[model samples]
Target: MFKVMTGKQAAELINDGDSVSINGFGSVSHPDEIDKAIEERFLDTGKPRDLTMIFASGQGHNKKGAYADRLGQEGLVKKVIGGHFALMPQIREMIARNKIQAYNLPQGVICHLFRACASNKPGILTKVGIHTFIDPRFGAGRLNEISKETWVELMELNGEEYLYYKTPRVNVAIVRGTTADPSGNITAEKESLIVDALHICQAAKANNGKVIVQVERLSTNPANPRQVIVPGVLVDAVVLAPDQKQTISEIYNPAYSGEIRMPHEQINRVIDEIREIDRRAGVAKERSYASMIIGRRAAQELRPGNVINLGVGLPEMVSIAAQERGTINDLIFTIEPGVIGGVPSVGGSFGASFNPDIIYSQASQFDFYDGGGLDIAYMGAMEVDQKGNVNVSRLGDKVIGVGGFVNITQSAKKVVYCFPFMGGGLDVKFDNGSLTIVREGRIEKFSKEVQQISFSGNYATKNQQPVLYVTERCVFSLTIGGLALIEIAPGIDLHRDILGKLPFQPIVSDQLKTMDMNCFTSP
Candidate 1:
C-alpha cells in the first residue's frame, strides 16, 4: 500500500544513517521539493544524521540549491558515493578537506549496481574499471584519505578477471515523476529524461527500504497501466509538488519533454543563451587557436554514417568544426543522457537534445555504450603521461569523476583526444599554409607520469585500438612503442616547438608527416 502526502511529510522517512540513492542526471529529474524538505527537516530538528548518499550521476541546480551539498553542508551525510560531483562545490570542499568519506565510481557501474541490487545479486562484476582509478589495484574508487571502506575488489571467476562492485544497502530512494494516480501509479512522461527511476525504486524495495517519490500532480482518475513507470505496489510514498519545475534550473519547456518540436533555427538561440550563461559562470571556452586547430583535425576523423560521441571541452568544438566542413549530415552525434542523432545541447540543457531522432531511457543508452555501439569518441585531455594514459577524470585534488568517459572511450573503436602541448598562455599564428607558435603555456600537459590514468594507453596497445592525440602543433598516435609522434605543424620546429616543449621524449616515426595545409587556410 502507498500513501499520497505533502513533500514535508514524505521527507520524514529519511532516517538517520540511511543509505540514500537519488535518481537524476545533472539538474534534471531531481526530487527538488522533497530534497529541500529533507534539508529543512534537518535544519529544524537535525534528526537525520550520518547518512550515506549515493547517486549514479550529478543532481543539483547549482551551488546554492544542490541537494547533495545541503546534506554535506548540514553534516547530514557521513559518506558519499557518486558518479560525478564537480558541480557540487560545497560537497567537493567537504571531500577535499576530508570532512566526509567520499568515493567516485563509474556512472555506468553505479547505475548497473542498482540492477544488481534489484536482482538480489551480491554485486556487479565487469571489466570497465580495469587499469583505471576505480580498479582495486588503484585506490579502489576512494576519492579522499578518509574513504577507508573498500566497496570494490578484484575478482576472477574461471579464466576471466573482473572488478566486482560490492552493493551497498540502499535504505531510501528519492525519485521524481510527472503524475501519480490514486493507486500511486507513476508516470515519467513529462520528464526531460527518465534516468534509472525504475531501478532506483526497485533497488530500495529489494532492500525493504522506503521509497519517496516527488510528483507534479496527482491524477483524479486512474492512470493507464502503460503510463506507469513504477507500479503502485512498489512505491511507499508520493509527494505532490504543485509548483515543481521541469528541472530545477528550468521551468516548464515543451522542447525538453518532447511535447513540441524545437525549430532547428531556434536551437542556435538556445545555444547562444547557454554559452552566455556559461561565460558568466566562468566555464565558457574562448575558442583558442589551439582548440580550433584540434577541433578541425579531430572532425576529419569522422566518416559518413558513423555513430560518434563528442565529449565536453575541446571535443565539443568538433561538432562546430564538422558543421563548418559541411559534414554534419555525414555522421550521428550522441550524448550519454540517451539523446541520439540530435544536436546535443550544452550547459543547463546538455542532457537533453534539440529535435532528437530518438530518446531512450538512460539504461538503454548505457546498454548501447557497454555493448560497444559507439564507433568513435572524442574526449578532452587534462594530462597524458609517457605511457599514453590520459587523465581527464582527475587533476590534483579536483575530482572530475569519470562520468561516462570510461564507458564511451573504452568501448569506442577509435578514440581521439583533443588537447594542447603546454598549459599556459599558448599563442599561435597562421601564415599562408603554416602555423607558428608566438608564445607557449608554462604548464606541462605531457608528463613523465600523469596524476591519474583515466584511459589506459597500455589497454589500447593490447587491444590494438587506434587512438590519436591531436594538438595545435603536433599529433601523436598509440603504437606498440608508446606515443608515436606521427605528424607536426608545418611552420613549427620539431625540436623547439614540439619535442623540446614536451617533458618527456616521444617516439618519432621515420616517415613523420606534416599536417594538412587546409587546416590552417580554412575559412
Candidate 2:
C-alpha cells in the first residue's frame, strides 16, 4: 500500500511505446535521479523502448544532466516533442543522424497544451504559431525530415489563425520537488525553480496514468497543508533522493526556492559564478564595445518599475549593462523559467537565481505574458529581414524551437531585438568616442529575408506595437515603411559600413542621427 518506491520501481512502470512527460525548464526542477534510474533501466533491460518523451524547454542548462538526452542516447525515447535542443547537443547529434523521431514545438504552446491534457479537453487552439513553421502548410511543429507526423494543425476560427496542437494523454508523469509527506503531498521548498510540476502531475492522472514524483526528503510531520502543490490523492509513486541538488551546478540554496530572502552577499554569488565561467572561457570581464553599445542603447528603453522580460543571447547583455549601470534592481526582471524580480543568471544557469524575490509555475508566468502584463521584452535575434521579421530559432540544421520567444515578443507592449550587426567573428573597437569596425564578420545578420519569421514585424505593426532593432553599429525601428535606420554609431560610415554591407537596403531616416557617444564609453 506504500506509494514510496525506488526510482527503478518507478521506471519499471514505463513500457514500450508509452508517452511520458518529464517536468523541467532550462534544466532546473527536473527529476534527474529518477531520470538516471530510467536510463539505467533502459541500458540494463531495454524494456521501455521507443517511448514518446515530452518536455517543454531545454532539459539541462548545459550538456551534462540532460535527462532527455540520456534517454534518447540510450535508445529509450523514440520521439521527442519539446521546445529546445540547444542544450542537449549529444541528443541533438542523434536527431541529426535521424536516430529518433523528434518534433520541436514552441515552449508556451506545449506548456499550455499540458493544461488541456490535464482537463481531458479535446485539444489546444491558440494563436501562437500561426504563419511560420507550426502551421500545417509548413511543417506543423515537425523538426526534421525524420519527424513526419504532424501533431499541430492550422485551423481558422472567426477569421483568426490558430495552431491546434493535438494532445496525447500523458501515460506517465515524472516530476521532482524538495519534500513529501507519508501520503506524498509535494512541496518545492528547495528547488531552484518551480516549473510546471502541478500540471505535469495532473496531465498524467487525467489519463488514468501513474504520477511518480521525486522528492529530496520525507517530512515526518507532513508538509504544511497550505504548501501542498500536489495533493496525496493524485500521486501514485514517490521516489526519494536525500541528496538532490537544487540544480546541476549547485547543491542547495534556500534563497532559490523563495523560502527566505537572502542578503546582498548571497545574491551576488550567482554573479560571481558567472564571472568565473567567463574567466574559464577566456572572455574578458568587459564585453566588446559593439555589445556594450547595443546593450546601452537597448537599456534606454527601460523605465523604472516596469515588469520587463528578457530573452537569451545578446539581449542578455541588457541585464549586464543594467547591472554595470547599477539600475538592474530599479525595474522588475523576469525570465521564462519562472524566476521573478532577480538579476537572472545568464548562460548555463539560465533558469536559477541567487536572490529571486519569488518563483512561480512557468505556466502562470506565461499566462501573465499572454495576458499582456509585460511592459517590454528584449530578445536576441539571429537575423532581421528587410520586412523587419526577426529569426532566432532557425539556422543550418538546428531547429531551436521558439522557447518563450513568440509568447513574449507577440504580447509585450514594446519589443527590442538586441544583437550585433553581424556575426561570425565581427569585431569592433572604440577610442575617444570614435567607433571602428576592426573586423567584418563573414556572415551578415540583416539579410534580404530571414530563414524563418519567428517574430513577425507585420504582426507587431498590425497590433500597433513598437519594435526596436538595437545593433552595435546602428539602431533601427520598425516603421510602416519597414526597417528605418534611425541612428548610426559615431565614426562609422553610413554608406560603406552600414549600407554597403547590408544584404537588403533599409529605409533611410531623414532625421538619422549619430549614436550617443556614451554608449562606446564606460557605464
Candidate 3:
C-alpha cells in the first residue's frame, strides 16, 4: 500500500549523497513539493554533499517559483546528469564554476536508459552518438573537471559497433501528475502525452529506492485501471500538490490546435504588412530576410486543427509571427515534457516557461509523442545534409546533446526546419526602422555530411513524411532524388548564392519565386 503524505513529509525519504532521478522535461511535469522538501532538508540537515541528481531533460522552476530553482539556490545538488539545462541559469553557473559535475546526454537515450534499467538490462546501445562529441573518441559528455570519467564508451555486439550508456542506482524517484486515485494510480490526461513514470518507479523499486509522487488531487476511488499509469506497487509515497501550477502554459497563453482557423484574407493582410516592412528596409533578398521570412512561411503551413510542437532557436520566433497574424488562437502549441497551450521559453531557458495551462510529467509527454498524436513540429538545425538528415547535437567543438528533437521531430507528421543561410560571424545594421545585412555569415550549416545523425533521412524518406528546409537564401524539400531547391531570395543570383555555398548541386525547381518583401520593416 502507498501512503499519502505532504510534500515535505515524503521528501524525507532522501538520504545524504543519494542518487536521485527526477522525472521532468524542461519546465513541464516536475515534482514541486518534493523538490521543495529536498531543498528544505538540505538546509536543515546540511549532510548531503556530493549528491547526484539525474534528470532526462532540463529541470528547474524559474526564479519566480520553480522547484529546481529552489534546490539549486540551496546548494543541495553536487552533480547533475541529463540533457539541456538552459532554463536554469543558477545551475548552469554552478556547473561552469566546477561546483558541480554536469553530464549532457541525448534526451532520447536518457529516457530509453531509464527503460533499460527498469527492464534489468546492462546498458543502452545505440549509434546516435557515434561521430559526435558524445563518443569517447571526441569530448564525450564531459562538461567540467568533475566529469572527466563520465565519457560514453564504445563497444561492439556481433561485430557491430555501439555506444554503451550506463545507468546508476537511483535512491529516489520524484514525479508529478494531474491526479491520483486512493490506490495510488496516477493520471495526466491534461498533459500533452503520457510519460514514463512507471518505468522510473520500477527502476527505483529494483534498486530498493523510494518512489514519491506529487499530484494535484486525490480521488476517492481507484481511477479506471486502464488509465492508471503508475501502479501503487511501484509507488512508495504520494504527495498532494494542488497549489503547484504548470509553468510554461501560464507564461505564454497557448492556443489549442483544434481552434486554429484563420481567414485567408487575414493571412494575406499580415503577409502584405511583412512585405512592406522588408521592402522599406531594403531586405528584398530572401537570405537577408531569413528570420522574419521563415517565420511568415511557417505560419502559412499551420492548420487550424493540428497539434504542433516548436523547438528552440529560430522556431521560437514563429510563434510571434503567428500571433501577429491573428492565427495564434487557431493552433494548439505544445512543448516537449507535457506542456500544452503555453508560451515557449526563449534563449538558454529552453526548458519551462513562466506560466502554463497544463503540466504533466516528462514520461507522459514522451508517450504522447511516441504515440504519434502531434500533427506537426517546427525545429532548428545546426547542419542538414543532402539526404535530408538533420544534426543539432554536436558542432565543431560543442556537445549540446539532442534535447527532445529526436522524439518530437521523428514523430510529428510534418517537420519544418528553420535556420539562417550560414552561421559563425555576421554583421547586421538596423537604421530608420529598417534592417540591412552589413556582412554575411561565414559558417556553412548545409554540408555533404553532418557531425551526427539526429534526424535520420532514411527513416524520414521511408515513412514518406514531408520535410521542409528553410534558410535565408533558399528553401528546399527532401525528395527521392535528394535535396530539391524550391525557392530563392530576391536580389540573389542562383549560382552565386545557392550553388557556390553548397558542397553539391541540389535539383532546382523551375517555378522558384522571389522571397516575400514584408519581412524587413515594421508593420
| Ranking of candidates on TM-score, top first | 1, 2, 3
List residue ranges in candidate 2 displaced over 4 A: 277-286
Write candidate 1's Cα lDDT for 1-523 as tens digits: 8898887788788888889998877777778777778888888988689999988887764565475556665478889988888767778778888989998888888888888887889897888888888888977889998889988999898997788899877879888899999888898778777788888789899999999988988888888887688888889999888787765445776777677788767977877887887778775667787788888988889899999998877788888788789888788888786678767777666677666677666767878988889999999899998889998877778877888888788889899999888877888889876788888787888998888878889987888889999998889999887899999999889998878877888999999999977666565
Question: How much is 132 displaced in model 2, in angstroms?
Answer: 2.3
Top candidate by lDDT:
1
Off by over 4 Å in 3: 61-65, 73-75, 157-160, 189-193, 248-290, 297-309, 316-377, 381-401, 406-416, 421-469, 475-487, 493-523
TM-score, one value per model: 0.95, 0.95, 0.68
- Candidate 3 lDDT tens digits, 1-523: 8899887778677777778887755555667678778777767877455677776776653343365656664357778777766556677667777777778777766777777777788776676565455667666777667776663689889997678888756667888777888778887643333445667787888788889988878889768876677887788898987765554433211222112333545544534554454445453233334577677766667888778888866786677678777777677777775567645444323444333555555556666776787898999999988888888865644445577777677678899998887776554544564334567789888899887777777667767979888876678988887788987665666877678888978888888876554444434
TM-score of 1: 0.95
Backbone collision tally, model 3: 36
Off by over 4 Å in 1: 61-65, 247-249, 281-283, 521-523
Per-candidate local distance difference test: 0.82, 0.80, 0.69
- Model 2 clash count equals 0
Expressed as tens digits, the lDDT of each residue in 1-523 for candidate 2 is 3388899999898888888988887657778888888888988887788888888877864454466567765467778888887767666766777888888777887788788899988788777766666667766767677888879887878987777888866878888888888777898877877787888789988888888889988888778987777887888889988887766556776666767777766666766776677557554245566777888889888888889988776777787678778788798888786777866765545687756877888888888888898999999888889888888877867656677888888889899999888887789988877788899887778888888777888778878899999988899999877899999988899999999988878999999998887677775
